[model samples]
Target: MNNRKEKTFSEVWGEFITSQTAKGVADITIRNYHQVLHNISKYLDIEMTLDNLSKSKFDEMIVEMRKVGIAHNSIATYVRVVRTFLHWCKAENIIFIELPNIIERETVKETYTDEELELLLRRPEADCSFCEYRNWVIVNFLLNSGCRAATVRNIQNRDVSLADSQVIFRHTKNGKIQVIPLCSRMVNVLRGYMAVRGGVAEDYLFCDQYGGMLSHNALRLAIGRYNKSRGVAKTGIHLFRHTFARKYLVDCGGNAFTLQKLLGHSTLTMTKRYCAIFDADIAKNYDNVSPLAQLYHPKEKIKKQSRAS
Candidate 1:
């Protein structure tokens, strides 16, 4: 055959990985993919060239991955990314092996228990005057809005639209500006904090003593220390978010699609994980529509059918 542009599988895969790494995917994601490919490459006993890889090799690699305690979720992510690259290779007529067949991943639930949430929200503030007040406001806002830590850290005074009773998330994980309704408590806190904050200070709502934007790490550490001092466990900003989601879904009887939209998740499937973790009573509450209670003298279904016949 004439010379073709069919490239080696290994070569294309390497290039694809490099390109994806440059696109701002998380460091953990990059490392996991690299490690998975490296292990697969080693198991084939040879170069494990993409053109030479077979179904048997893929199966052995998966078994080894399981033996090493890699989570199914992680493996599923790897399969997705790898398959995307391999499909591209196939389009170019360069595939020697098909992508590994993996089961659909079960979602991992990460919601906080009520006790953990109460501990996080009630973590005592430091004796610092202004800092303590600001942190209280921060905790309250996080509990009410379910905003991510990054979004909470980046809140500017202008982001709060008091007239509309809304707060805009400027830099969400998906880069969407999500506008959440400001709870009355949040509005009151914001008003009080702003009354103390001078109008001339042109920066974030919560700033360091130096009048700069708040450091995400410092905020995290402060919250952690506060929790430690109170002898409460599991103190993280994410826990606040988890608490907010669970409480709102359970206590307020909110729907999944609405929660998904409010939280700015890209998919309903992502929000379903939170729903799945909720107590059975919470899920049942949403389904409790009693026709029997509404109808005092309802006709029996079998009797009604017999009478009609």
Candidate 2:
């Protein structure tokens, strides 16, 4: 008998993504894919072989994930990953099955109410340290610039052009470069940060105490520490980005396409998600206009004729 074939779709997909992800995907995202694939393979009893995977097997994987209490959103991510890989397999002339439908993603916009943001910004904890300052800057950067956390992690010293009042983001996930104009306050704050924590010319703007680049985990830990020290509710950085996008769209009437480009989203649908995030503001504006304000009152002549009759 011929020896069993050893190749698998999962193996091939992992290799392909590892080789090609550098061009369009961020380093952190590639790492995430590796972890996602690893866990998925372990969940299935059989090794992740190309010959064994089918639409029915994919369906079973989702059911298993749900049984284990994985959140629907997380399951959605797993489905997307498998779908993308399988589609690539089909394109590459490998084994193909009926493509599985993607798990529907729910839209939940987490935002800070204006009052809450004002309170957080105004009052730093009494026991605040450098970490509070770091959190403040991170929040300010995300809210003011609408930059993603990934871009924030990769922000380098050279990317900032203080004289021109612009920051260059080169390594965005969307494969486009953007120059974001900075307001005076942001420039001043950034200048202060740079002066206090100096790093090598090529190093990131946000660095550890030892002047090394700050990793995502370090930033997250710092934020956590700051939240604890300040006695504030825990919140992630993306909330700031959402706050920025919603406020900009509602108050400034920022164009959807422009906002999408600035946010480095690959599609308008992602930007449109933020439109709902500003629904309260939209409702307020709508309330200001009423048909009662323009409705014509009955004429005095008609009233006089009715009185005469």
Evaluated with lDDT, which candidate comes out highest? Answer: 2
TM-score of each: 0.66, 0.81
Residue pairs in collision within model 1? none
Q: Which regions of candidate 1 deviate over 4 angstroms?
A: 1-61, 81-108, 123-126, 129-133, 195-202, 206-220, 278-309
Candidate 2 TM-score to native: 0.81
Question: How many collisions between residues are there in candidate 2?
Answer: 0
Per-residue lDDT over 1-309 for candidate 2, one digit per residue giving the tens place of the 0 to 100 score: 111224665668666686558556778778777877877875564455666667888778778988999888778787787777766666766766765566456465677777667655664555655556667777777777888777888888999887898899876767588888888988887887777667667887776766676777888787666655545575676777787888787767776787887787878987776445545555555634656643543345644345564
Q: Estimate, for each residue in 186-273, the C-alpha lDDT of model 1 and write its tens digit.
A: 7887887777764443478777666677766788887776667556666687877776777777777777778898888899877776
- lDDT assessment of candidate 1: 0.68
Regions of candidate 2 where Cα sits further than 4 Å from its true position:
1-5, 8-10, 22-24, 38-43, 46-48, 66-70, 103-106, 123-131, 251-255, 290-309
Error of 2 at 106 (Å): 4.8
